[model samples]
Target: MKKLISLALALFMVLSMIPASAEAAYTQAPMLDGMDLPPVAERMPVEPMVEDADYLQIGTYGGELRRAADGGNWYNGKPIEEGLFRFTTEGVAEPNVAKDFDVNEDATVYTIYLREGMKWSDGVPFTAEDCVWFYNAVCLNKIDSKGIRNCHKDANGNPAVVEKVDDYTFTVTFGTPKYDFIEALTVDLKWHFAPKHIFEEMVQCIIDGKNDEALALGKAICGMEFADVGALGKETLYYFWNYPGIPTLNPYVLSTEEGKNNVKGQYYEYVRNPYYWKVDKAGQQLPYIDKIVGVTVSNVDQKLMLLLDGTTDFETVGMESIPTILESQTQINIYEWAGADWGATQIHFNLNVEDEHLKELFNNADFRQAMSICVDREELAGLLTDGWLGGGQAAPAPGQLGYSEAWATKWTEYDVAKAKALFEGCGLVMGADGFYDFADGTDLVLNIVSVADSGAADTYKVLEPYYRAAGIKCTFKDSDRSNIDNDLLANAVQVMLAPVTNIGDISIVLKPNSMVPGYATNVAWYGTMDETTATGDLLKLIELKKQLDVTASTEERTAIALQMLKLHEANQWTLAYVEAAPAYHAVNARIQNFLENGVWSDIYRDMGIAHCQCWFIAE
Candidate 1:
């Protein structure tokens, strides 16, 4: 009888080795016939509303706009200096200093005409010369400015050069024809104009007298490398600005007053740019708010609590806090969480590694596909969050550019059996210890790395069990935010949970070449361009992005978008997930026309706290 029992147990184990049938499989639905979604007129434009006389008029007066944020340097927000030309919201570019702009044939050259009479806050006349000089200081000269670089390289892979046409006008020429040149211009933070007078004067001082004072001034303004300003001609300035350019710009002049708090929060207040050129339809001078005060508070919980208490106007919240925030919704109205469909959250597979066993498991397209099937985003969303922060449609989050509900619904579904079948069918047999192993005797284990922050810590804990049940060994590693740079460069991480900038421009997010040096936001899983055999689909997506600038028809753009989506779905660069916590802005209840999106700082101009025109004190 004992022999019979032992034999029965052995038979059961043998049966388990046979692959189980999948409860679900990839279903190829009929290709969607082009159906007209809502007309472009019905959908929201990047800038949805023009000024209206009946627009809520608030008392335009002096008041400080207080905001709380996680740790960031004054250098970080220095891009705001680019004024009129910078991005206020995702995918939308409005004139900052330029009253308006004009583009030429093929959208390669952009002629930007600055609004005359605009001056630096210091009362110096801001001219076309200033614009040209500023461009040169940051881009052409590559001065160590706190701006972002937007222009493409020449055929030989050098920064594109700019030419000044006149005091009010300058033209930007790209190395390659860029359809989204204007979009790129608007989002490039490095395009911020510096006061040429201030910069040139410093350089002249250094050249006239190469003393310690002059050297100190040069270093203060341009860093230690600028000890000899004589060599810093137009060409030299271009490279200098590329790395650690002076964080100088017009929007918010930097104040030297030091703060007693953390260095991150020390001594920076953004005063209104008196030279700010944009005006309301009624001809009122813009930037209605008196001042913008950014306080550095690194703790996320403290930041959220401050928001609840009305000490801070805005705070970044994620999925873990959604339930808590929703449960306390009576405190305030949570504005739209911006990243609903911006991009996807993906489990990236490292295909370039030389390990035979690791490559065989990870590079197996079927294995990856099987892993994707078992991940029920809906269930994860429920377990991870609550309220509006739950499982959402895949692809671009809903309400974002290039989002398709049909595609989202078709791809995102829960089927555990299918995942199991695919796992077993791949010839991974279970061992006596209950862990699955491949034919060559390799066990499946994964190490996930995330920033050592509260949000990430909570998320990793929640996801631990799901991976364990699938016979996969899961390990979590915590990394400091400061070490993120070195970690990514050294390939010291396997999986990283980080927030990507959501500007709504797909080109910036997907292009392999887009991940330039200093632009560490790009997921490094793909490695640099020299390292990988980027598929034809990726190359085609880059080509389509270049076409976005000139393509006149939405249909053409949509077709390109669909192709990109199909590729993304098949390859899984991003794993689409729901926004866990929408951002919450607590106003004085008198503020009106406050446009809130998922992006931070996008609605500053429209806020009653920033632009006072739309605000009124409660009676």
Candidate 2:
């Protein structure tokens, strides 16, 4: 096995990339105003991936791409900051920082190989030690870890163990077979590696109980740019934005200027990372653009205005901005793509509640089904997506692995009599004004909550009167996104009507938090194997997930996946789903290798941006 891997590595090094076009084989990089860089060949990985000459044109390296930061997930700058194993438009994993990988027959162990000479923006070698440091010191460490480490843990409560094979290769082994590793690694670029040389000393000091010294050194290490925000002091450096000293594998590096504030500043400037490893077919280092300027607009409206005025080059088409995008000039290309989605708009019931009647009423499936029938989805879709997208439920949105068309419209019809039947069955009666009261004639007001920013407040404006027309009096409440999350975690929430946490990847089922909530999206609704959280009808889901964890057979895994989807289907625990609209992107003609039709989801951290390293400025 070792000999085979070594031979494969040699072949990879000698591999020649042939671009579709017979163009010049090499080119000089754009001269930086005051900076000098080594030749592109000297800086790239030993085996630079030759881009598909068919999809992308071989390029000259220059020009800046301008964009705006719409305070949304992915399709933002997350791609400019690339990941190790990037996902394609179809969600297939492609090596970027990674060179290649292999799995044992049973899928219990995975050996991932890194590109030789892969370096961070700071020109430090990226090796297996970095991967080990990140896994041990940051991810698995109880005190310093921020992630739930759920994906890395097994059914028996054993975590995936990490072992370094060499400077360039490492193996991750789960107690059971974990087929979801590939999908999980590609999502959100959750590559578990970092520059050990950069963070270890100060981290060691902190571990040794030198508090003040560590704190002071921590601030220094992050440099003062991230000092005020404590970006440097973060447990993991994955998102320590603007900390120039923080080494990264992304194609671009954040500006470290003392006063550079992405939020307050007019724009945040990201420069090309000279150490970027990929090259075009013509052998030029990748990311043809010299810089990317993310215009910092305070609100979505301002961000849209920038795109409309032609100051910004690209952005996702917010459902609200469809008309504007359509009316734009011919220079801009627009395309519709489905997000890897769990569900869009969903009304969450706080299962763990203090208010007795409200809790019983919310936990009632008949009442929940009634609420689903109240809204005319055709009209709601028209309002939210302008009739461009439709057909959904509490189940996974279309195109996800186990989506069943039969379950989509099961109870989605706008039937007043049927809704009245479901509501009345839950011990509710209508008053003279057409609104329902309790069996004891107590007026019922269902308060649905949401975060103010996601336009859920606006969605509520549409749903409030709609529900009232169905003899149900419901009100809308808004809070910050963080507050809503905190409320859910603390079990203080009553009802949350917001975007159902969409799963952009199949790994979501393995993690299984959002749609089914088996493993803690927020105080599991059905319950989980973990004794701390309540267990419910969803135990089958937990069992299936565990079985999938240990089962090596693909056929068995697929069958189990289908079973899990069926469980969510029967439960209807999540009340309803809104349409999954195309992630709207307005691209300028100057941008090359931009996919007109693509799957853009945050399931892979900023899923659509995985192609960003391949995207370059044609101007």
Candidate 3:
């Protein structure tokens, strides 16, 4: 018994000395103790998938693809002379020719690394020096450059500082700490990098009095005018290099011959770039598809017909096509998804000219509230788009960074009597001409302008009767796309239907500088608010945005966002409308990994078209 007790005590002592025999240690001992172990894989709480994880994996190979767009000049889309970046279907920004990147502590400075061997279609080597030269010549000078315009200026509007560390290393210094610094490196077509060697030689020749030689060189380098060599100093060169002016950077180069003539009802081809940097997961060269064809069609109707017949692989659809697409659902595959296209439609009012008569009629807060109340957004949505789109507020959508839905339910109801009473309380007297009169008995004529293509004309037609019953003479004017600028700039119309793009970033859409006044959108005919006050407020909000990380709590950010929303809403620039018909797309069954964020409207640079290296074919 004594021996057994001793044995048990010895075993207990041995076990205690073995350090508790844990399944695994949560932490390792210090280096001085010479104990280290690999960390166990932590099991994270499973998160619900926002979208389907398993997607169609369309293999990259031979397939003829067709796409459509409204008539516009290639120059209209060109920011630089060459393609530097291109959008992906997934909408995540990826490196084009750039192999990788390194960012500094405050994120103000960035070091970009390029692929070892890259060449332009013209056979010129694309190096980091080209990037540096381009920035120095174009972006800084803002001379028709294609570079984005964030770090180039301080909040006070000073030139952003930049330096080139080495041939392969470039550094950018911002006047302020901008978390979105990496976005600045994106390529714009107008600010596309020209062969520095070629351009410099031309400049040198011109400086040496060889005008004829310089002119020839200019045409050869990138078709630029070199008449004024004296004015083409280093500063001006830099400005032209960094201008944010183009839509995308990708492996495909724009064909100049096809771009010139109004090439309608034809296909524009984009071939794979042999020098493209990205590789597939299987180590195959990117842009697996041999070519991309952009086909020009008369309208969405024709495009939809072609899509259904399998004559075309892809085309952007309008609201009118949604019903047909749905009705013909089984025969045709539809990938109708929500995404950012233009922006939400808005009712814009001119706020600069203070007409007491107009003010007395519209300035009454209740009258504005009543105007908002009478419009049944859901009903209007059904009528305009057949209910494919709905639920966005006059304020931006909720998930947007600076968006506020606080006033979404504030006045979104159909109450015609309440609207009339609100107008009556404001002392707007109904006149014999079926219109309301001010205190001085002046007739209220509100002219509303709308783009010819958008369904605004039809929308105004529906509102005309309702507004007339409320003693308002609302005149509707439809203008072609070309005449829209003249109409808005001249303030030729009082009320206009316009889109407020980037509603998520209200500052871009709502500021006085916004195309529209009183609204965050540019379609507002009124000029932007006092630049000093609005800009100061914007700067504060921007700073607040920077301080808050992506992982910040929604409640904490909501307060600041609400304050910004209130500023824009109080100005009454944009009478926000619920989404009518959000754009939709259809994809083939064989096209795999087709994913989209809520804002994918038109094809943009971030979507993974170039990266996916896949082709869509009829199953």
lDDT of 2 at 461: 83
TM-score of each: 0.69, 0.86, 0.67
- Residue-pair clashes per prediction, in order, are 39, 8, 69
Better candidate by TM-score, 1 or 2: 2
TM-score of 3: 0.67
Give the per-residue lDDT of model 2 (tens digit) for 1-619: 3213344334443453333342245454565434676655556666656666356666667877787754322334466555567665544565656777888876778898887777777877888999877777666653232443666665676878888999999988888767667655654236677678877876676567666666676667654433222233353354544445667777777666654434236666777778877777657776778877777677778777787777888776676676776676546776666565555677777654666687677667788888888778878877776676574676666666767777777788887788888988999888988898888878888777777767788778877777888888877778765466556666667777764354334444444666444454544242122334335655556666777767666688778878877877786777655755557677776777886666655555543343666676765
lDDT of 3 by residue, 237-287 (tens): 432321111112343444444352222325555444444333333333334
Against the true structure, whose lDDT is highest?
2
The numbered model that scores best in TM-score is: 2
lDDT of 3 at 97: 48
Measured on C-alpha atoms, candidate 1 has an lDDT of 0.47
